[model samples]
Every structure is written in C-alpha cells, then in structure tokens.
Target: MENTMVFEEPMTAEKCSGHLSSVEDAIYVIGGKWKLKIIIALHENGNIRFNELQRIVAGISARVLSNELKDLELNGFVKRVVHAEQMPVVVEYISTDYSRTLKPVIMALSEWGRKHKKNIREDLF
Candidate 1:
C-alpha cells in the first residue's frame, strides 16, 4: 500500500475559519502568475542562476522574473545568493527550507493537473 498523508478529522467551525484564513494568506503570498512556477523551478533545480531560471520558466521576461524572485525572497520562500568570486559575479536563487513545506501541496497540484489534462483530452476526443 502507498503511504499517503491524510487529515482524518473533520474540520470544526473554528478550524474551518482558520484554514480559510491560512489558505488566503498562502494565496496572497504565492498568488502571482509566476510565483509558484518560480518556486517549483527553484525547488527542482536547486541553486540556479538568474538567466537559467528565466530560461527554465519560459515566457517570463527578465523584468518579471526579477520582480517575482524579489517577491519570493521577500516572502521567505527563496534565497538569493551572490557569488563575487566569479569574474563578472553571479547571482543564484535557491529554495528555502520553509519553501519545502509546500512540497506536498505542489505534488497534489501536479497530480490533479495530470488528471485534469487527461480528462480534458478524453472529453475532447
């Protein structure tokens, strides 16, 4: 049997309100069009340079990537490291341990996305 995390208890009224607030807070932090994608890329690639991240994310302009990375760093989900040893200097972005807390959420979303795509494909055909 596969081990899966589950919430066994039903949410109480207070718990429901707290959960909703927490979800709203989370959405506010990572709510932008590019924030979660940027986080996922950093999580997958580990430490990545700015240019590389832009390439990996695709369709994001340098300005937008810069803005999003700053937001992620500000939100404590990502860290920006600068290496001065390189000739031209280098900057890299890495996911924080705090960001790892979202792994399960990301995985669940990925699983749902796969199923959604399959359902759409089936419906179309």
Candidate 2:
C-alpha cells in the first residue's frame, strides 16, 4: 500500500489572507525587470565592482541599476561594501545569505520559463 498525505482541514480565510500577504511581500522584494538578473550575476561572480556588474547585467541603464542596487541593499538581499584605504575608493556589491534562499525559486522559474517559451513557440507554429 502506498501512503499519501492529505490535508485534514481546508485553508480558511485567515490562512488565505496570510498566504497572500507573504506572497505580496516576496513579490515586492523580488519583483522587477532586473532584480533576479542582478542577483544571479552577483551569485555567479561573487563580489564585483559597480562598472563590472553593469557590464554583466547587460542592457540595464546606469540609473536603473543604481536604483535597483539601492533597493536590494535596503531589502537585505545584497551587501554594498566600500574600500576607502586606497587613493581611489572602491565599492562592490555582494549577494547576501538571505538572497541565497532564492536559489530554488530561481531554478523553478528558469524551468517554468523554458517550458512556457516552448509552449508559446509550438502554439505560434
């Protein structure tokens, strides 16, 4: 015999509302044209300078990237470090441990995106 888990109680209004609030919070943090892209680049490259990150996250304007970095830093998903000892001060961005929690979410989204694009292409043909 196979064992399976079943929900003993259906989700109540309170539970649904709580779930929605949590999801909305997540969306507010990570929802944007370039947030995930920036995160992924940082994860791949480790700590990187502003101009290097701008180059890696191709197509994003300086203003938008600057804004996005500030938002990510504020949200605790990224760390901005500065080195002032040198004649030329250097600044870099690093992905926080909190941001690593999104790895599974990013993987799932990547898979879903590939499937979605394939489906759309099939439909178009």
Candidate 3:
C-alpha cells in the first residue's frame, strides 16, 4: 500500500471552521501533485536553473512549474538566485532550510512508491 504523508488532519467541521495550524499551512504549500516533486528535484540537484528544472520533472507544463516555483519561493521553501550576467540572465532554485523538514516525508513517499510500483508490476505480470 502507498502510505503518502498528508499535511492536514482529517477535515471536520471544527477543523474547517477554525484556523489551520502552521503544520497545516506547511502541508498546504508542499502538499500537491507537483510541489513535492519540485522540492525533491532541487534537493537532489542542489541548484538548478528554471528551464533545466522544467526538463527534469517531466509532464509539468511551463506555466505550472513557474507558478509552483513562485509559491515555493513565497513560502520560503525555495530560494531563487538570480545571476548577474549579460542579456538573458539565469535564475536558479535552491532548497531552503525549511524544506529540510520534509526529508522524512520524502523518504516515506519514496518507499511507498517503490513498493506500490513493484506490486503493480507483479500483478500485471
């Protein structure tokens, strides 16, 4: 079974009516189809340029990647470094200290994905 780590508790009337916790906001920022993927990609590569990141994480469109990068930067999980070059400078996305907190979450997701894929392949075969 895939044990994906969720950032929010069970949504109930009480939880919904009340303010979300910091953990909840953290989850909200990093909890998405592509948000975590971006984090992991930056982590593995240390620092990567915008276009390079778009290429590494397949299937994410340019607009979505750009928007997510902005969100991550806004949430302080990513640091955007702008290089001072000639025409058409470069911007690199680097993982911030806040992102390190999701290390265990990433580990769990990786293990779950590996197990789930193996199970699927086994069933198919």
Candidate 4:
C-alpha cells in the first residue's frame, strides 16, 4: 500500500484573509534587514557581548544594533543575560528556542537566494 495526501484548491476568502494576517504578523516581527542578520549571527556564535555582536553582524551601528536587540528580546526571539555579580558587570545575548524555529526558514531562503543570484548572473551574460 502507498500513502498519499491531497491538497484543496481555491482557498476560501476567509482562509486567505487569515493567512494574510498571519504573514503580516510574521513580517512585522522579523521583516527588517538587520533583525534576521542579528538573529543569524547570534545563532552561529552562541552567547556574545554587544560590542562583539556588532563586530560579527558587520556594518550595523551600535545604535541600530541596540534597538534591534531590544526588539528581538521583546518578541521572544532572543534573551539578554546579565552577570551583575561579576566584576564590571557582564552582559550577553543568546538566541531563544523560539528563534530556533527559524532554522528551516533560513535554510529555504538561503537556497532560494543562491538560485536567484545564479539565475540573475546567467541572464546578465
């Protein structure tokens, strides 16, 4: 026996509306240029300090990085941990489990981006 699944066509207006709302919410959370870059850097480097993070993401100003980190923390995608008990007070940012959910999404986007770049290059020739 073989297992198969079928999808329905012609989505209802209600379903389409709901989907659009969901996509909007997602974009609002992670849409900007720096947000995903910050997230990706954090994921790759593990916990790191603010200055180090700025260095890793590259081209992002301290002001912009500070704002983005606050946004990510608020959205449950990143965690800011402070070691106040230590000398001079240490701080680090870590990617939350919620952020891990974006792994597949990042992978898919990377693949599509490579293909798109290649196609564009070929077209230019």
Candidate 5:
C-alpha cells in the first residue's frame, strides 16, 4: 500500500473544483504569515515552550506567537501540553500527526523558493 495522494486522470470541471477546494481548505488551515514558520520550528525542535518558540521563530511578537499557536492548535496541527507536575509549571507546544502531513508540501515549497531566489538573483545580476 502506498501512502500518498493520487488524483485520477481526465481533467473535468468538477474534479478541478474539488481540487481547488482541497487546496483552499489546506490554505485555510495553514495559510498565514507565521503558521508554517511556527510549524517548522516545532517540527525541528520538538516540544518547546512559548518563549523559546518565539525566539526560534524570530520577529514574531509574543502576542502574534500566542495567537498563531492557538490557531494551530485549533486547526489540529499543534498540541499544547501543560506540565503542572513539577515545581514550576511549564507549557510546551508540539506538532501533531496532522502537522507531519505537511512535510512534503513544505519541502516542495522550500525547493521552489530556493529556485525562485536563484532566478531573481541571476536576473538582478
């Protein structure tokens, strides 16, 4: 069994509409200035505290980070864990299984961005 998304051939208006809707839904969940960045940071760093995540994401204000985290959690891409067992309670954010589904998409986007940057630099020079 292959673990991948496969679209059937034969282009039709209905199929295109369905595809567009799927894309839009994905964007709705992850489309924001800081969502993907926050996801990438959590993905790379494992569980992290709010302040640490803010530092890792860089340039995102505390309020924005908090809001983004809440959004991500609401969308099922992130998990918030509150640790009240220890002397000092701690809160951490971790990427959920659903967030892992975006890995390929993110990598493809990153590749495209790199190529786009190279093209821009070449054009400028």
Candidate 6:
C-alpha cells in the first residue's frame, strides 16, 4: 500500500518553544468522544436547543453534553443563543463556519473507517 504522508526525521526543540496554546485548545474542543458528533448534528441542522442536541446524540449524559457544548462555544466552533420565545426560554446551539471547517477531517475519518471495516468484514468471511 502507498503511504499518504511523508515521514521526516524527528526534530529537537531549542531551550524555548513556541506556544501551542491555540492548537492545544482546538484539539481539546474537538478531541473528545462526543464533540464531533455534536458538531455533525449542528451542521446538519441549522440550530437546536439544549434538549434537541441531547436527543440528537443519544447515549450522552446531560452533564457531558453541556460540557461539550461549552467547549465548542469557547473554541468558536459553535454559537449559543437564547431563543426569543414565550415565558419559557431555551438555549440554542448553532455551528459556525469554523465548525464546518471540520468537514474534511470528518470525511477523512469516515473514509478511513469504511476501509478498515470493509477489510475486516472481508477477512471474517
């Protein structure tokens, strides 16, 4: 099989290294188990309330979902808004283009998973 990425020798850092704060923050926002699925839900549907997002991604606890949404909002991947409705109000989650930017990453992961599944299935039979 052909390799997709070129490998290079390891690097050594100087006494001081550039801050990886933003990069680390981005990874932290999207690196969790359920964050990507949450983004996918928002991307597919323009906006959704808290309960709606919880429904969209089943098997996720309320606390976990809340944390993921907070992380997404902090990282600029999602925007949280208050609904202009009646007495009872709701908080909605919407994906920003920044979240949509994850399309290629998600697509690549899906393609890789599909290939792995196919190979495994073939091997089984």
User: Highest TM-score: which candidate?
Assistant: 4
**Model 1 alpha-carbon drift over 4 Å, by segment:** 1-13
Those runs of model 3 whose alpha carbons end farther than 4 Å from true positions after fitting are 1-26, 85-87, 116-125
TM-score of each: 0.82, 0.88, 0.71, 0.90, 0.88, 0.78
Clashes per model (N, Cα, C within 3 A): 0, 0, 0, 0, 0, 0
Clashing pairs in 3: none
List, residue by residue over 1-125, the lDDT tens digit for candidate 2: 24654557887899879989999999999998999999999999999999999999999999999999999999988999999897699998999999999999999999979988998999999
RMSD of each: 4.1, 4.2, 5.3, 4.9, 5.2, 3.8
On residues 1-125, what C-alpha lDDT tens digit does candidate 6 reach at each position?
A: 57565536443353114336665766766887998999999999888988888988999999999988888888899999887685587778899988888999899989999999998999999
Better of 5 and 6 by lDDT: 5
Candidate 4, 13-79: lDDT as tens digits: 9988998999999999999989999999999999999999999988999999999999999999999
State in Å the error of residue 8, model 2: 6.9
Over 34-120, each residue of candidate 1 has an lDDT whose tens digit, in order, gives 998999999899999999999999999999999998888898999999999998999989999999999999899889899889989
1 or 2, which is superior by lDDT?
A: 2
lDDT of each: 0.91, 0.94, 0.88, 0.94, 0.93, 0.84
lDDT of 3 by residue, 38-59 (tens): 9999999998998899999999
Global local distance difference test of model 2: 0.94
When summed lDDT is taken over every stretch of 10 residues in candidate 1, the lowest stretch is 1-10
lDDT of 1 at 51: 91
List runs of model 4 lying over 4 Å from the truth. Answer: 1-7
Write candidate 5's Cα lDDT for 1-125 as tens digits.
25666667776899889989999998998998999999999999999999999999989999999998999999899999999997689998999999999999999999979988998999999
